[model samples]
Target: MDSTKCQDHEPSTKLLNPEGPTATIRPIDFTRSPLADDYSSFFAMTIDNLLTPDECARLQAAAGDNWQTLSKGNAFRECQNILVFSPEWASALYDRIVGHLPEEVKALRKGDRLAEIVVGPSHLKASVGARKTVWRIKEANDRLSFLRYQPGHHFKPHCDALYARPGKDERSFLTCQIYLNDAPLSADGKSDGGETRFWTSQVGKRQKPPAMECEPAEEKEAPFLDIKPKMGRALVFQQRMLWHSGQEVKRGEKFTVRLDLMFERHFEKLQPNS
Candidate 1:
């Protein structure tokens, strides 16, 4: 038998859409948000209309094989890191491109068969990608997505980056989270739980630290954006600069997808010029 014929696996040659153009995340000019006060949390913001109900349903259906329970041992004691179980819908979405690429990337792309369930023509009109404000950090060192699962079973506290292994620029950039399911605990009419909390840190502590030891804060309040986990709603921010956490699931189970991006050293200038 020919070796090519005998082989069941083949290499993929799909050229990804060129890491679109450079995108800038800015603060609302009208309102004074803490997020606007400092550039540390600059890479972060929330986007609505990323997905629709139909698309969420499709993702839930696809998210089966990728589903895993969030273990307590792996849960973040100080920062918000926890393994989450993908919902049936999200599991379905995970299955769509298991081999094509990383599950998180597929989840973020808007044209997958599963994604079209809720993706409307206008969905991308004002989106981060469409606006070309978020230029994919194409450096070889750019950070990719990390698939995570958080059941209604867990919660994490306010802290900065952790769980990221060694790689240039990985820890130095921003973090964006896309909600896969509307958690019941999520209020504010956005979605449910699986909230992304933004916290306030104490003075004289401007360095990033490991996510274990409890760090005392001068004071803290509800997240600047207590995001509800709505499918396609992306929460963006600087992972290391923002003292944020995954709020506990109180009502129903939640499903979420996470991705972290590291920008070029000088691109931080594109950040809010605080």
Candidate 2:
């Protein structure tokens, strides 16, 4: 392997299974955020202020009127209720905001040549399993969901499920989220804890546990990353590679919009010359 090339020796299976060894969280500045770089081996990154305050407010109002309680098995029980946007609504939002992305972010979204070079051929080959390939962006924008959390609400630690459907050939490979509002402050002017927490360790098949129930005895002493909600900030990550949770909202309401980026797989079939 070339030292200049970005690569990870760990098997991709560990990313999907989540029973593997812990991986430390590495933070990167949004201005120099990795698009098609070696940093992708970790599969997660944050981009600050991806949305304008006006956009966040507009979406939040729409979600407020449409909120619905999320069911137990559908989402982790600890997650609060949510409002899902119609496909039309989501697509419009994607169109409006995608142009503001950095050149690398745009390339990654389109899966362009630079993205392929940075992420490596093996990563792409393993993901779609085609000898010859063409990558296209398939947005799950229509499936965008808005989540709200009040005091004590939280989403437990878990890895996202691999996107697979019995009849569909496409799959979701990435997760994206935009924070709509700052974590609300308490009476004393302290922020309520509505941070998204990422753990160094993965959650195995021992039955998914609630965030409160599964927390380490000395949370302050544990190795983890906590990202506080900030208005307009966005986060993107390889869905299957990270074990994460929404920490409890300690004082006031927290709001966010979630979207997934999918890829449609296509392979060329060889034809015999007549």
Candidate 3:
């Protein structure tokens, strides 16, 4: 046998599971879990606001300022977000702000330009820390966004990790999901598919082009924790660790606002945690 051309071939050296070593599920109380701990579960907190029917209607009407409905009337999906800087609410919040610079920050318009408007001190202060909170803002950051699920509509099993960019380099530290409306319960006194399911593992993270078929067996039966969406409540979680998806809507609607926080200045500048 020729040494150059007939040399024995080496065995292929590749492990089937890429994350076989450093993957796990750490359990902790969903109600009072610390931010530093890594958790792969869904959690939510009901806010302490009690708005009377009249007040609810007024807020709904005046909500046009920063409020954006997901779909038009009659549509199955409807949601809103960041009313802190909407034009209709702008003037009111402006009056609430000290010195009220109306000329400098007039209308609360959508996009990157509305950052100059400041709503109020209480609104700003409420957003501090990892607590489930909201703030009235003159403008929303680029990463902040909202979503809604209408009657009969559903967001199937999916993961926040899907939002993670390529190269295994960058990831968002926090994902804030807030529920603005509560779905009414049925005759049995149980709400429909308003639960948020967070999967611990078995998601197909294999490299493939977008829209490619995912590994079915691994995703369909993953261990999961379900969280019901309540009005004025919010959930904060580590984006990459949790694979979450919305449950099917059996009766009333579901609305949620999402804020994805990127630690680096821009998406491109993200680096793995040191």
Model 1 Cα lDDT, one tens digit per residue, 1-274: 0011111211111111112212223332212555544333133455554445555444434333333333443554312223323232223322322222323322222333322221222322234432221222321122222234344444454444433335542222334565766656435644444566555543345443423224434334532645556655656544333466566555666655554443321121223322
**Residue range with the least summed lDDT across 10 consecutive positions in model 3:** 1-10
Best by lDDT: 2
User: Clashing residue pairs in candidate 2, if any?
Assistant: none
TM per candidate:
0.49, 0.64, 0.45
Model 2: which ten-residue window has the lowest total lDDT?
Answer: 1-10
lDDT-superior candidate, 1 or 2: 2
Residue 19 in model 3: shift from native, Å?
45
lDDT of each: 0.39, 0.55, 0.39
Query: Which is better, 1 or 2, measured by TM-score?
Result: 2
Residue pairs with colliding backbones in model 3 are: 65-86, 66-83, 66-86, 70-79
Error in Å for residue 268 of model 3: 21
- Best prediction by TM-score: 2
lDDT of 3 by residue, 164-274 (tens): 345532334345565657765789987777787765433345453212222222446555667677654445444433445666677876655455433221112112330
